[model samples]
Target: MTTLNTHPTTAPATSAAGGGGSLRRVLWAAQILLAAFLLIGSALPKFAGQSDAVRTFTDIGWGQWLRYVTGTVEAAGAIGLVVPRLAGLAATGLIGLMGGAVLTQLLVLEPVWSLLPAVFAVVFAAVAWDRRAESRQVLRSLRRAPSRTP
Candidate 1:
């Protein structure tokens, strides 16, 4: 009987050789930092009843409740970024949230600085995309049969 090579083929290593891992780590760190910053900077002021923050939230018609909700989500997403299994999903959720923020700023606020949200959204989207292939590989490995569990 002819023996078959059962070993799986590895993807060309170069696909991830050019700074992909380091870049992905940096992106994850940056996303976590941004989430923390947003949570503290925006949330604190609203929670503290600062005049400018209150006025801005009021004028936006979204109210303080929305601020609380957003801050909580950001904090949760930031925490999730550090966990490998949850990172992809968290990044995806954060990107969606940031995209919504960008749209709100564009349509409702119409400020030139509104682009910042979109920029952040793009960064998070990149992070999610870069990690996706690896995440899939990991999932596939997990689903594979356990070798002779004794």
Candidate 2:
């Protein structure tokens, strides 16, 4: 379906490719911005052993190792978000991670802390939704690949 733009500043999608391209660009921008914020604000601190990260992990009683692991995953996911084909998978992983964060906050910490992770999860879900076709294609390719068994 083509999208009709009322304003001259934005051109309407003339074909399926054009519509998909426009949508993809929009989703890509959103994913990049979100990934950058997460990587810089959250992942770097954990990797660097910042006081706040240490304190939060200590409070959660999960040990400092989990913080490092979380940081690594976040960094990887953020990197994946910038790759056009990997954005959906990246967002999917982040959604799972954020869901766990939300649960941990709700169970171990105050309710207020849970809100942020919950919000992040929602945004990740949106990215996944927008890239559903690409994600499904990847999955299909994986499923159809020949086994390497000797």
Index of the highest-TM-score prediction: 2
- lDDT by residue (47-136, candidate 2, tens digit) is 999999999999999899999999999999999898756778899999999999999989998878899889888878877877666677
Clashes of each: 0, 0
Q: Look at candidate 1 and tell me the lDDT of residue 100.
A: 73
Q: How far is candidate 1 from the true structure (C-alpha RMSD, Å)?
A: 6.6
Each candidate's lDDT (Cα)? 0.69, 0.82
Task: Show model 2 residue runs off by greater than 4 Å.
Answer: 1-23, 147-150
**Backbone clashes in model 2:** 0
TM-score of each: 0.67, 0.79
RMSD of each: 6.6, 7.3
| Pairs clashing within candidate 1 | none
